[model samples]
Target chain A: MAQMKSANVRLEKLNKHYHRVVAVEDVSLAIEPGSMVALLGPSGCGKTTCLRMIAGLVQPSSGEIFINEQRVTRVPVHKRNIGMLFQNYALFPHMTVAENIAFGLDMRGVGKADAGKRVTGALDLVQLGKFSDRFPSQLSGGQQQRVALARALVIEPAMLLLDEPLGALDKGLRESMQVELRALQRRLGLTTVMVTHDQDEALTMADRIVVMRDGRLEQVGGATEIYQKPASRFVATFLGASNLFSGKIETRDGAGALVAVAEGFGLLVDGLSNEAREATVSVRPEAIVVEPLGNGAPRTEVPNSVVATIDQVVYRGFINHYYLKLPGGSEIIAYQQNRTSEGASSFAPGDKVIARWDASSNHVLPNG
Target chain B: MSGRLEGVGAWVLYCVTAAMMIFILAPLLVVMSVSVSDSYFVTFPPQGFTLSWYAKVLQDRDFLDALQLSAVLAFSTTMGSLLLGVPAAFALVRGSFLGQSFLKSLVLSPLVFPALVTGLALLQLLSSFGSGDARLNLLIGHIVVTAPYVVRTVVSSLQLMDINLEEAARTLGASRMKTFWRVTLPQIAPGVAAGSLFAFMVSFDNYPISMWLANSEYSPVPLVLMRQLVNVFDPSVPAMSTIIILLAVVGVLILERLVGLRRAVAI
Candidate 1:
């Protein structure tokens, strides 16, 4: 059944300008059939603007939107046949749960008997079958969110749009709903686009993540590519914790290049272009290894190693983070997983430590 | 010493509030007392208890005509204000347009304008437009005086509503009109009912506007009562005043039941 109704969307050079401010600029993306894509960014980063344009609530300044190869940029919002779950759920306060879910089918001119069956099925899918007669105010927050999801799905729209769907939920509920919503989407093979500022939500649910910044696209890739190989400094910082080292290229070696840091440290990195004069290198915090100075260990020594003092230590449940101050006053963060057998780190604040990473772990970024 | 001062302040506040209540209710109470008087002349104190004055006032043809005219005018004003004011409130609150602040002030400005001035202006404008009938002029005057209350009340309710509800409706395949009728209208129904009631009462009890616009033969109930108070010393005058007071009280109670009294007044 899912294979019979696959959904595809193609946005072509979409631009939305509100008076003097350009809300979304030249954004073009193709969402594959039966996959979830997330537009991840901070507030005022144009993620919501892009979603609104796709929902046909905001007209683009210049672009064409195609849903299943049909241009729908000029279509009226109601006539577009799309479903959206608002951040606040937006269930009709006066209507019961069943009536809210039946609203779309009724608007589409479906018969009462058929609409009732679909409403029941939709409610059952969301596990709210018995609460169909309750008003929105009578339900819990989580139940209301599910009813909103059910209402959107009952229409079986060509594509589903969720705008910060879990923003109003508590932390634990948000995490659980992320898993539940992802499973539902996969089970139904519904094409979905979600707008969220949370990196964890994007990584956990979306098959592809489009990171936006300042009303423009920063990078669009799978979770691993976006995290492991960020195209820019903003993407690297926005997606996760990364230690950025500013350096100038000194020379080129076989399959690597040498760089000179400001703090009297020379390092070699892999995958650096020969013509690159200066670069900002990003290394993930978890990729760095911290040890006591002068501890003899054999590892790949092609990259940077900094002698630094541990400034602060934050212990999360499964990991410990160390903030290290390098010789040149630059700060770097390193994360170490807590193993059951290994005790906690002996290094305290103000203790000298050697922070090291392999050359291949660093990705050279263009300075902006 | 501080505690003693607080007690003294509380007593003073209670006295002031009681005085205000008596000041506001004095006229209505006097009219009620005079309506049951057995004396033939209208006065503050009754000579004796009787209902014959009420019966006499109720049967008078001129008084009935004035009462019917006031009712018709009040009903028409309420309907007209709702039709005009609700949409104006929606536009002022929800729409993003240039001069929105200016437009809002313009809609509510009639509240601050003197009723006599508005009545005179409407009378002049209507005569220029070839409307010489007293009822038409009075209807126009009442609409002008009452529209601001409707606009203000509806706008207050519109501000409290969640705008995302309308967006959600649109996303669910509801057209703009359907979204309004199904979602926006229900949320603001209390305000709409309260505003119309206020419009009706203001038009019904208005004197300054009716005096300037009404012809001698077609005066509203309030204007007629005022004329009787000036011209005659009959007990029927108080009886008629008592009836008018009761009608106003009923209108207020109905509004309070529809929407809370506190909200209607605050809005």
Candidate 2:
């Protein structure tokens, strides 16, 4: 591993339009050096387009890009000195693993002897030293991905861009490789930007997550911050399952505001002003506590408590999901982790239950 | 009853395949045998299997000159077609512009047009300009017919290639020329080789085109072979045919060794 200069990348209002269709619109962000940030979004959400623009594969329609404070908006892709791993890995089928890894060095006009040594070092870095003689077709999918990773890193690039790096692998391999890739990226101290639609991969690997939707940034924050306090309904639903409640604000308060959903149905929300007339709040499924309402135990009145009937109960291996229907005929899901067999809640469909959460758990999405 | 019909269908398929193979190979086998025959005249079941005709054909001054001329013409035509066809294929497969499809059809129309008519047209077109170079005219005519094969094969190869490989090379610091040499060329070498082999073989044995384009001073092997066949009915003619056939077989085998024949001809 050679010492790499981690670059600070900044996109200044990057916009890409293919005729009338806007691929990416007004995307501006600054990426810190040696940190992994994920552009998380669904397909056709312009995450891949943004990454390609950064890689210089796609030119931005009307914006500038800077790498390490130097403008590169018009720089050609080959001269950018960036390492990119495509979704398909893009290993040259005609070249052996060693030769594939040596391609970048060869392009840079590195001497053959030195290139061979570095290729060996890169192979060992990815733990594929023994398979250097094999072609890409002979390697397994995971092995091919590792070869691609090694090839990208061998160039000692300024930054690394990954487009769905683990999307090709099976579930088990994908999880393991996510951890492995993150560790390798950290060890190299290379600034990396990865584009992935899978939220779990973003959460597990990236230090920051930029949630994108419809060519715009929905939210940008740390994984836990974005998950717990999403800025928009799109972020709340896109990242994970969230129970949403939309209503009109009824009262103003210094600490919290109350939102009225139906007649006599007021939901207390914490940390909000009465500036907006309408508001939408989200609560995580696991954050809500579900208890049997009509049992010998009396139900305690809570700030965000709502008496609902369980519409369905789904038993996932490690957790149980309760789909509850509130009095206003809106459906909400609550997840209860099955820690132990004796402590697992045994609620079935049509069972009367009280679904409640603290005021702090109810996050008001400002622009929802 | 359906099972029996399927069995009969399978038998019919096998019979048809065998008949087709024999139909294709029978004349070739007969010519090969007659080339080695001991008789003065061309005879099949090849009298005593002598190699005298092969030696005698090799000694003929007219055949030697014709062989040299055809060899040079075929080699030059292969090179010319490759030079023109490869870039044309790249343009056809990768470029996007108005009338692209129309241009594609126009480039490939030579394959469907009768070569004899093409030769006649080229003769008229070249003569109208008073282009007196017979060999160059013949070369141009042969290239018009053979370049389409090169373009077609290379186009199929380019189409089947994964585009991401080139992108990866670019991201790996390869310039456009470097990427083409290191990634694109190697990937499509099989198709290029196959196309060149086709051009060489087609140009070497071209009769209809050569019949219109060739003169006494610049006659190619096919014309000389045809003239020999008409003037003298001997094993020497079959011997010369065997040599051409052997050259074609050797070319195919060399191509197969360089890149698998299955891949080369897969298009």
Candidate 3:
């Protein structure tokens, strides 16, 4: 009924070890108030472990967690005043919808009269007011998750933690709920943290994405920034498909660095330091343009142009993917949009094609 | 042609199932009919229907006393088994400790060990301790055998229960004790109900253990029924059996009303 005071959460050098196995290692992060941050990674990469540590469900081996600038690392789960939605949407099977929502209020010592009104309000908030008397088994999966959400929010927690909230839903429902949940979190301005292995989900819903790998933070930034300017080869591949070229830096000047690939082939990357002697550059599939070389195609005077033969053609509804093989026996992929109903017909297998991109599109990553 | 043969095979299976059901029920049917027989001796085809044997058994003081003692013993054994078995189930299912498997085997060993041997061993142990009360001795023996049923059913129920439910309650501001009361107990109620039913019935109809621990002053119904069957040649034995069967049926019906018979027994 009142405005929620969204709190800033901070984790300092969090480490969790189960016996000799490290689950999370020296991870530090500061979440801004009123912004949703998604922990995105593969399974067993410590994203869920990070979320659990913040929820006080899993105690960090050596770390300090602060909520609203108050130390809560040693606090018990119930006293943390945080709401968490599990992946399974753990609704009490014995309690009705209203009873499930009212459980938290009852534990907080809310009186019966007030609790009744709040329970009704929470049900209406999730658009399930009529289903309050029904058991959880009678509701669909989407309805059950909504009831779980309503139960978590009725406590008016300072922060909301979601662990793969839409993982159990069907594809169509998951997409729709993603939009709806993001809108609700924005309206409430609740500082939220969610864990998911779905890259599309993290890209679509989060204000900031924290990519993790091997129990460590890989990259953390806005979705577009991390997607475009990935810091490593793992990020470049994991976020989306990329064509990588490993080379030796031949020239370094005020303009940029020139990387030499195979004999008589070179690539120029913009806005990179001259100190590195070798590097691996990545270019996204959608950024590369493919054209037949003998069709009088006007080519730009860029060092990124390469002659390659089409190895295979994949026809999607709105786009077509061309897998091409270079003279050095390396493979590169390019995506072209289908402007007509027949899809892209400009490239086919065994066709000699020239794939190219601008110097600015190349992202130089460290040679590791 | 194959479809016709398959239909014939299904008919054969159905007939065999029906025959098995009748075979299992025939003994009880004969006893029930003899209990209501108006003849002087127990007969397969009763001449006429009468409730006189039931009336006779109800009026007998020794039969009444044995009935009271059996009911008390069965009721006390159910409570005692629950008190000892539910917590053991929890510890074995949820706790992590050394020799956990060994402890589990120890708790459930009575189910596999012969009940007659358990009774004899208990008799020797109790007499060695200088405790000569027949009621206490019989109670201890009954609990030892019956507790395994409670432990088994409750353990299976605990294993099947979702652990996330408890964690969700804890996150929802419920303490550990409160979470158990509000979440865990309700989910496992059918198993506990089934276990109590088994405990009551086993302790009520027990014979071998009672043979060792029971005295003339504290005799159970099974011993009394055995003595009556050996000495008499009348319908009263069948009548006593009919009463016990009716009590068991009533107990199951009450459990069904409390928490769905299908659910209670499905565990």
Candidate 4:
């Protein structure tokens, strides 16, 4: 078998327009060689359009695409030598797993003898070596997906592209396939660009995620960076639920800034000292810790604290979600683990409580 | 009581279906019986059965010529419509252009138009173009009438198919022609088969169009059979009809085996 040469894919100012509608704006991205990058966005956000452009399935109205430092913008899809897995698997129903996998080899003029060996290798990699003779309709959804994956990888293309690769599977199967697909891509060290609307799948499977919104890039980073230090308000809300507080910066200091929020409340944002006079800050629900007023002094040194009335305690399976109404009429949520019965029983509705979180948990955004 | 009622309802349904099948097949059975009758004249309770009429019909050189002409015309018409209609259907279904729906309706209008009117209109149009070869005119008329079935079947088949398979093939390094030939063609094959079968049967059994278009030199079996029916009553007419009916039955059986009867009926 020939060694697969992983490619570094780059799109420079790529733009796609369907008449007056802009499907993808001027997007420039450089994906590292042998890395699995994800284009994550909601539907119609142009993540798919970008992926299709890279695959040469959709032509860009302007700009260029490069794989392994060679311009391939004008190249036809078949000549691009890229592998793609469709959302529906698109496995040939009339063909067996071995025949589907051998399709790429036959196209490249590989002899029947050599193609047979490669097909077996690909099926084995997907852990379906014994199912090669079975037709696509004979297999389960996950099994069919594995065959699609085997078919794409058997060609040993320069880069792999997936358009919502696991979107068709049910929840349980989707999660397991995410893990398996990530492991396989890493093993092969093939640069892959997967487009998906599922954020958790992107975070779990991608080395770096590029988030898009309305044909524009929102934020590009790892999971924690986008979660803890979101570059924009959309990123913070889109990736996960965040309680946003709009305020104006009143003072600046070494540690942080004092921002005056609603109801004359000033928040001490640990890292927003000198950024701007007007800003927005975000705090995750899990970051806020709730304490009953009469429970005594706090053990943890949390500087930012707010007194509020307990509105609701939702007893979920693993946590008691505390919904607190603050003095400023804004609602804040705190999640307490259900590990101890003592903590679960400590809070009740309308009880006076203090919600405290570390000042470092405040993630300040520039505007909007 | 409910189970017994259900059984009775199922039995009633079976009886009704059986009656319907008999209703459809009775006329063909009558023709077959008359063709075998030993009597010189046609009668209902076909007198002592014999194979003489069939032999006489087969031996008639003019009848043979008409049957051969109809067979060639039907074959040519099937091939012509398939060649023309499949690509037109593909363009209509896949292409995004203005006036597409109007174009499709125009192509499929022959099915909705009255066959007599269509036949007269086609004869006028062909003659006005100054092409006087009666057989060629008949061929063209049959193609125009049969092409709609080909288009309809192909379009329906293409719709049911997974179009992403074509993209999958292209991404696998197969060129556009190869992708269509290897992937798209096989996926919609049932539709093509069904369409050609429909075209052949419609052309072979055609009377309304053939009557107006065929000349004496190029008379088809149906035209010849009609003339024979009008001139004099004979069991030989029934014999020739039986042969044609059998041919139609065999065509239907082949179609059912190639593309399931359920699919053909659904279309």
Candidate 5:
């Protein structure tokens, strides 16, 4: 059902400075048509500033914005024809759901019959067909958000911008709405840009994730590329749980590079070239396997293995997280999934265990 | 023993509040009762109930003329105040300008200035203009007196509003002007209405400003009532005062119904 209206958005070296504070530094990004890109960062990391610049709510100190290859840097927000869903939903309290949805159409001088039809269709799209007569105060937060989405969509904007759309919802509601909104965006084929500080939301919903830090773009790539092959130490630590082992590269092999740990332990990481002689290697906790040392169990043919004492064991409902301390006093975490039939291993704190992982599982990130 | 003492203290407080209410309302009740009295002389208690004085006051051409003049003055003053006050409030609250604090203080200074002083100042200023138009002078004086209330109410309401709502509207394809009309104005409508009501009441019930500014040909209700009370011993004076009180009460009630009484007062 996707119509595939060209939604290519290009931002070229956008910059915004408030007095002496640089809100958004020099940043450039190209979003493909029909793609959902999430600008993910911590608070004040320039994600909202970028979204505002795209929406024309904020003027960039320098640079240009292009929609479908047409430069629209100087255009005002109203003329930009982009839909925005605010964090608060911002549904008009005085207006009923139908009137809220019909506002843009009314401003465009659409006739009563046509505007009403479009409002109904938009409300139905959000599955709020029976709530046309209810004011915003009567609706729940999720319902209000749906009404806001319908209002924006009724205008059939060129692009849709969601600024922390689900940030106000409860945990379960936020998860469900994320999936529902992603489905709607895909179904409508609307080029969408969403700003969020939630890493899980970005990973779950975005086709591409742009990681930002201190008003600069740290990395921009697919979810797997950002999570597995983060370009910098900041990206590695920000996107997910990773145990970073700081060291200098010792030797380069065809498969991976060998790195010298702080003390005596040596580590091997995949996809590192010889040129990367000084780098930080990151290993995800879920990638490491843990077993009792000298247990006589058949080991996988992974490149790097170390025997460490368990420093802490945190039993989560689905998995157990083990913090392992190596001989050199550096620590790494390993997760063991809990199966009812097999039961969890009795690995308590201070127990010694062998931690192992394939060389391919390790990622070498540039030092910030 | 402590709970008993607390209950006794609460009862004492309630009795004091009730006494205060009675003190405030007694004169108004007396005026209303005397308005309907059958006796020609002003008395604390009416011997008989009658609507003759009200009918006499309503039929009097002088009283009717004064009432019409007061209505016209009140309405024009309210309109004038809103025109000057809404923008001033907007600028003071939203615009970052040099000497903004001074500007805000200047806009609200009329509230601090005594009405008699303001009236005398306007009289001197109007006389210097040499137009000799009493109605014009009264309008200018009333505008000065009422505009501050409008500004204060509107600014308070604007401060309470969620500024993000307007930004959200702008992002939803609304231009700046459209955002003001569609989002900002609706949110502050209650405050504006309340401000206009206060402005009207101030202009209508004002004596010091109206007495100084009004000529023999044009007198507001309060000025005319004061003139009749001082010059003539008319029993219909209470009837006229009663009507003025009723009008004020009615205006407040209508305003409360339109917005909300609590919200209006708070703003």
Candidate 6:
């Protein structure tokens, strides 16, 4: 009934080691109060291990977790007062919806009358109030997720944790639940951390995304920022599709740098120096513009442009996918937006084209 | 037509099943009718129906003592087996340890072992330990035999249950013991109910084990019934057996009402 204050969660140099395998490595982060951050990574990347550690379900090899500036590294899971929704929803089969929602309060020694009122409030919050008397098995998958959401929210936890909360739903329901869960989280202003390998879910739901790789933090930024400015080759590829090129930096300036990939051909890429010469440069597929060869040098000065022959053309409704072969025996894909009435069939095979983009589109990663 | 042939086959199958059911139960019906016959000796299609044999068996002090002994033994055996077997089932189902399969085989071996062999083994094991208390002897023997059923049903139930339910309970702030009571125990109630009834029936009707473990002054109902048949020539033995069968059938019915008998046995 009352608005609960969200708490800040900070992980200080968190590390989890199982035998010799590192699950999470030197991970440090600060989650602002009421903000939702997603730990996004591929499977076995320790995204789940970090979430479990925060929930106090797993012991960290070496780390400290603080909630609202209180150290909780040694706190048991039950005393942590955190709510977690599992991937399977995991609602108790034998209990009714109201009982499942009120179990946390009941465990806290709350009075039965008070628990009933809050359970009713929680059921209405998830819009499952009428189904309070029904068992979990009687409800559909989406309804089960909503009831699980109610169960997690009724406790008014200090921090809410979700382990792929909507992964079990169908594609349509998963998209809708993602929106509903985000709205609920925002409305309650509950500081939340969700672990998900689906990049789309993280981008759609989290305020900030922390990408991980091989049990280490790859990059941490906002969804668009992470996509536009990936910190490494792995992050660039892991976040989305990319076309990478190896080049030698020819010149450097305060604004950007010039990188030469082939003979007499240099692309002026922004935001790089001499140190970036040895690193690989990534260009997003959608960012590349593919035009027919006879168009001449564009009326507008195009900075980072390359000469390539079209190998294959795929019509995918909204966009035309042109698989282009660069002169250096490398292949890069360009997704041309289908804006006119012609749609994606405008491009065909064996057409020589200049794939170009702005200098700012070049993403340089340091060589390891 | 093939459809007509299938119909004939189905009719034959139903007849065969019914015949098998009667084949198994016909002797019990004979004993029951003989127990109610007015004839002095055991006979079917009796001269007249009377309950005098029931009164005669009820009046027998040895019969009453044996009934009380059997009831106590059955209750204790079921309780002990559940206490020991449920946790063992959990460990076997959830625990990953060296020799896990071996331990499972060891616990379940009693199910396939002959009751006479188990009885002999228990007598030797207890006598080797130099114990003379026959009630304790019978209690231990019954637990050894009956616990496998509890273990089996519980393992079956646990196998069918989702493991995430327990983890979800823990995340919802339930402690280990609380999670077990609130989540784990209720999911497996059918299997437990089934197992307890099986244990009770097996312990109550056991004869060979009770024969070897009988105390100097008393024995179980089954053992007493056997002794009556061996020493006497009357309808009272059938009367006692008929009462035992009725009690067993009633117990099965009550368990089926409480937790569906199909669910318990399916495990």
> What is the per-residue lDDT of model 3 for residues A1-368, given as tens digits with 9 covering 90 to 100?
55678999999999999889999998999999999999999999999999998988888999899998999999998888888898899999888899999999999999999999999988987899999989888899999999999999999998999999999999999999999999889988999999999999999999999999999999899999989988888889989899888888888877487888753477887666656677788899998998778766534345888888899999887888889898888898898888875546777789887888888888887533
TM-score of every candidate relative to the true structure: 0.94, 0.94, 0.93, 0.93, 0.92, 0.90
Higher DockQ: candidate 1 or 5? 1
Tell me the DockQ of each model, to 2 decimals: 0.49, 0.56, 0.45, 0.51, 0.42, 0.43
Candidate 6 per-residue C-alpha lDDT over A1-368 given as tens digits, one digit per residue, 9 for 90 to 100: 46678999999999999889889999999999999999999999999999999998889999899999999999988888898988999888777899899898888888999999999999898898799988887899999988988888888889899999988888999999899889888988999999999999999999999999888888889999999888888888888888877667767787477777652256676755434445468889998988777865633234478778899988888888889987777788888888777655655788778888876777776532
TM-score for candidate 4 = 0.93
Candidate 3 to truth, TM:
0.93
Model 5 TM-score, all chains together: 0.92
> What lDDT would candidate 5 get against the real structure?
0.87
Better of 2 and 3 by DockQ: 2
Q: Write the per-residue lDDT of candidate 3 for residues B8-87, one digit (tens) a residue.
A: 87899989999999999899989998999998899989879999999999998989999999999999999999999999
What lDDT score is found at residue A261 in candidate 3?
72
lDDT of 6 by residue, B103-192 (tens): 988898998989999999889999999989999999999999999999999999999888878777777788988988988988888889
- Pick by TM-score: 3 or 5, better one: 3
Runs in model 2 lying further than 4 Å from the true structure = A262-264, A271-274, A295-302, A341-344, B1-11, B37-50, B261-267
lDDT score, candidate 2, position A166 = 90
Would you list the C-alpha lDDT of every candidate in the order shown? 0.88, 0.90, 0.90, 0.87, 0.87, 0.86
Give every collision pair in model 3: none
Off by over 4 Å in 6: A17-22, A253-255, A262-265, A273-277, A295-303, A340-342, B1-23, B37-49, B96-98, B128-130, B261-267
What's the number of clashes in each of the models?
Answer: 0, 0, 0, 0, 0, 0
Pairs that collide in candidate 5 are none
Q: Please provide, for model 5 over A1-368, each residue's C-alpha lDDT reduced to its tens digit, 9 standing for 90 to 100.
A: 22547479999999999888999998999999889999999999999999999999899999999999999999988888898999998887778889888888887889999888888888888999999999888889999999999988888888999999999999999999999999999998999999999999999999999999999999999999999889988899898889887677777778467777664556776666546666678889998988777767534333477778999988897899999998888788888898887666678888878888877787878553
In order, the candidates keep a fraction of the true contacts of: 0.68, 0.86, 0.62, 0.73, 0.54, 0.64
Highest DockQ model number: 2
Residue A293, model 6, lDDT: 76
Name model 3 segments beyond 4 Å from true: A262-264, A270-275, A295-302, A340-343, B1-6, B261-267
Which regions of candidate 5 are displaced past 4 Å? A1-4, A253-256, A270-277, A295-303, A328-330, B1-13, B38-40, B260-267
